[model samples]
Target: MATPIYEFAQIPRVDPAAPARARTRKVRAAGQAPTVGVIYNPRSHRNLGADFDCSLSPHVHIAQPRARAQLPEALADFAAKGIDLLVINGGDGTVRDVLTCGQAIFGDDWPEIAVLPKGKTNALTIDLGIPDDWTLQDAIDALDQGGRVWRRPIAVSPAEDGASAAGMSRVAGFILGAGAFTKATQAGQSAHKLGAFDSMVVAVTGVWALLQSLFASRANPWRKGARMRIGLGASGVPMEHSGHGDPEMRQLLFASTLERLPAGIRPFGALKNGLKLVAVDQISRRTTALIPLVLLGKLRGGLRERGIHQLTASHFTLSIDDQFILDGEAFPAGDYLIGQGPELAFVTP
Candidate 1:
């Protein structure tokens, strides 16, 4: 096979040092850019100039690294710099890094963050009002629009920093992983160049991936078994034992903070208003029943008993093997604990 036909400078690394607020981005106007900050996992960056030039506005204060190794230190650094608003340029993992950085730095002063959709998932970006930008102009619109302030809930986990599963990062704007859904991104998760950012191109990629999964599933030899313990409100009473029961099936707990999954996962939009807890108990139970409602691209669904837009947990702890996937970015960390931190703010689109 031939080598990749692209340059090497367009990758982004995950660094948590409080990303420096966007100072001289050029697109930001004096007193208008808000206290902007940028964090990108360059590996997720496409070599397209639109990705670079569109974000070159004066409003952007950037802290970019060539690899993911710089994330922790960068988050710490950005926090020390004191950013009022953070504009992340990578995918879901990078978004979580920003959330963690906010908690590490200005705890209560957590800045409202906007996600600039640039990665394969761009999951949080679409969760916000912004979505996949097919054209260069569309990309610019996201940049200009992301610089604005919007209000949204930040999933607060009661766990301490770096203690829970993936630490105390915000949700609603971030994705979580638990089951077969997350294990499928190995082929298309590239942050390389010549990235086909066109809308139709994404459609084709979706179909191709599905076909591969179907064939691979036929050849695979794994049967359902106990992977971890999970639940909805309590740890294991069963969230879906009432109808269409699966007395013998064991549901692997695969949850995401967002209402929808990246790429081919589905949603009609019901997930926009509340946090979704996708679970596995017995195979007969439906996980994310509202997912179809969300995939339809509509944001209507049943609300919590109190009509709340988000769920606040004292601290959700999951005990399992180290099989958890964070923001679709697999980690080598042990799965002893996992949850959201105290309080971090997220600007939904």
Candidate 2:
């Protein structure tokens, strides 16, 4: 199990309702060429030393943030310019950083957003149904012609009040997971090195993890999983234990706000919209073998008894004893409040 990196006393709880969001205001006419802002990350996987058609139009302003610290200023400039369409030319990490920094700048009144799948994993774009061949010019053209998909990123912050204000910080992302899910993310890095990405990496990692868990001993970290208490909604209600395996350890815990996941893994079963999560208990080898079927939404009856719990909620609190993966970044093991951020429109081709 991953050890806690920060003492619980050091991390303050955050008010889920406290995110600052200003009211929306009218900015531009429909016929006007939208003022565009692109936050491009040179270090992204696909952009490594590659030159892209950076000029969609002269009005499209681009900022390359070499480090996370430069992100705020870049977003602030866009906010000041009153950009109508904000295009993110990186992957999920870039989108997470931009959203985290832009939260305070644009608030609830965000400009229309676009994602260029330039990173190793572009789950957000996948959920938005963006085409793999989408380019800057395509996104720019779509600003006027494409459809809009409105989504709210999941907000995760320290559970202690006012802790997020003291540099402990909060993050917003489409997907968050812990336990074996984190291990799979680490393994996905190796897959990425082997030239796998997006859905391919997801499928590869899923197979590898399923095989390992199927064959490994119960003590195996992949099967042993993590100790976590997930509380649903404002009342902090504990999830009902299915009594299939270890009560305290969830073998697989994955959550997302995305309507569609990368590999078509319907872990959420028929549930969709809002915040969706699937918590699985350690099960027998037969059940372990059925994981692929479960992921494909093939095995469905009596899943909760089989140790698969799929549900949706407005908000949740995760008090975990292991590091959780948020958009490919490791967040220290601590109590965290998980809820929806502002619903913003994403332009799609």
In the order shown, what is each candidate's alpha-carbon RMSD?
Answer: 8.7, 3.9
* TM-score, candidate number 2: 0.91
- lDDT, candidate 2, 21-41, per-residue tens: 443344667677778888888
State the displacement of the C-alpha of residue 32, model 1, in Å, after optimal TM-score superposition.
6.0
Off by over 4 Å in 2: 1-31, 51-56, 162-168
Q: Which regions of candidate 1 are displaced past 4 Å? A: 1-33, 47-60, 67-69, 72-82, 134-173, 187-226, 231-252, 259-274, 281-315, 332-338, 342-349
lDDT of 1 by residue, 81-126 (tens): 5555566776655665555444444444555555667665565555
TM-score of each: 0.57, 0.91
Clash totals for all models, in order?
61, 6
